[model samples]
Target: MQKYPMTKEGEQALRDELQQLKSVERPKVIEAIAEAREHGDLKENAEYHAAREQQGFIEGRIQDIEGKLSNAQVIDITSIPHTGKVLFGTTVSIINCDTDEEVQYKIVGDDEADIKNNRISISSPIARALIGKEEGDIVVVQVPAGAVEYEIDQVQHV
Candidate 1:
């Protein structure tokens, strides 16, 4: 099994979801299935089928979360001593050389990548290009939109 690199917060989020699914959703679905079964014929019961479908979905999600948490490699960004280079879990400030627009992004795991939150996946084109590069270095990232140039302004391990 390949280990997933994730932040502490991402691991906790998965654990919390797993707990909710097992404790709250699983029992609720069980109750629903029981109530629907009492309604009579299994062949023509819509409620029974619906409850069973919901049960499958809930169980699958529970298993998925459990598997991820079990094989995850948790990383705490604040503790590492980085040498002024962009690294995993480090936030980087960059400026588009051509457009001269400034933007900031924190390199995070795939599970925690949220563009709206300024978090990007380590495997992303921009992140891959920025890694191991220090401040004042210019990087060219290949995206679907073509090659874009960026100058690193700062790298913070926060």
Candidate 2:
């Protein structure tokens, strides 16, 4: 099995979701299935079918989370040495050379990448380009739009 990179926070979040699914959602779905079963015949019951399908979905999600957690290699950010170079979990502030727009992005695992939160996956094109780069280094990222240039202004480990 391939070990996947995941941040400490991402691991915890997945664990929390698994816990909720197992302890809460799973039982609720089971109860719903039971209630639906009590309503009518198995052949003609839409409620029973829906509830059973929902149960399958919940169980599948639980299994999926468990598998991911089992394969996760948690990367703790704080323990990493405060190097100026861009690394996983380090935040990079960049300035768009063409448009002069500045944006800060934290390179993180795929599970923790949320564009709204300024966290990007390490596999992302921009993050791939920024890797190993240090402050004051200029980076060019190739995207669907085109190749865009950026100057690394700061790299923060935190």
Candidate 3:
């Protein structure tokens, strides 16, 4: 019963996926299995085996999504008043102290993290260092290359 912290959009995405799996994918897999069964010999039916494997994967995903949704603690960042402090569901703008490169990242739940999209997981090293820090704070993150210093420039709720 571990609670999962996620933004409202993240929770909705997971719910949408669960709905698709149960309503569309589950039925399609069941239909495929039935069709494969009509072919007769169960011992030598490749279609049947493939359908079964697909069904297993679909069912597992459905269960996983359901579990996460049930334990989700959805946070609406827009509804919360911004205090200039870095927090979950907040978008943070940081500047590299050494390289002077500026970047923005939205702190999100583990399942919704996409580095390419500028969304980072709360458990990540940089996010961990940024959490609870206020704008204008300088934080150091340990990367594979070495320790990098970043200055927090802005914190946005949107």
Best prediction by TM-score: 3
Compute the lDDT for candidate 2: 0.92
RMSD in order of candidates: 1.2, 1.0, 0.9
User: Could you estimate the TM-score for every candidate?
Assistant: 0.94, 0.96, 0.97
Q: Write the per-residue lDDT of candidate 3 for residues 98-149, one digit (tens) a residue.
A: 9999999999999999999999999999999999999999999999999999
In model 2, the Cα lDDT at residue 152 comes to 98
What value does the lDDT take at residue 110 in candidate 2? 89
lDDT of 2 by residue, 1-158 (tens): 88888888889999999999999999998998899888879889988898889999999998899989999889898998887899988889999999999999988888889999999999999999999999999999999999999999999988
lDDT of each: 0.93, 0.92, 0.95
- Which regions of candidate 2 are displaced past 4 Å? none
Candidate 2: lDDT of 69? 90
List the candidates ranked by TM-score, beginning with the highest.
Answer: 3, 2, 1
- Model 3 has a clash total of 0
Tens-place lDDT digits, model 1, residues 1-158 = 88988988888898998889999999999999999999999999999999999999999999888888888889998788878999888999999999999999999889889999999998889999999999999999998999999999999988
State which candidate, 2 or 3, has the greater lDDT.
3
Clashes of each: 0, 0, 0
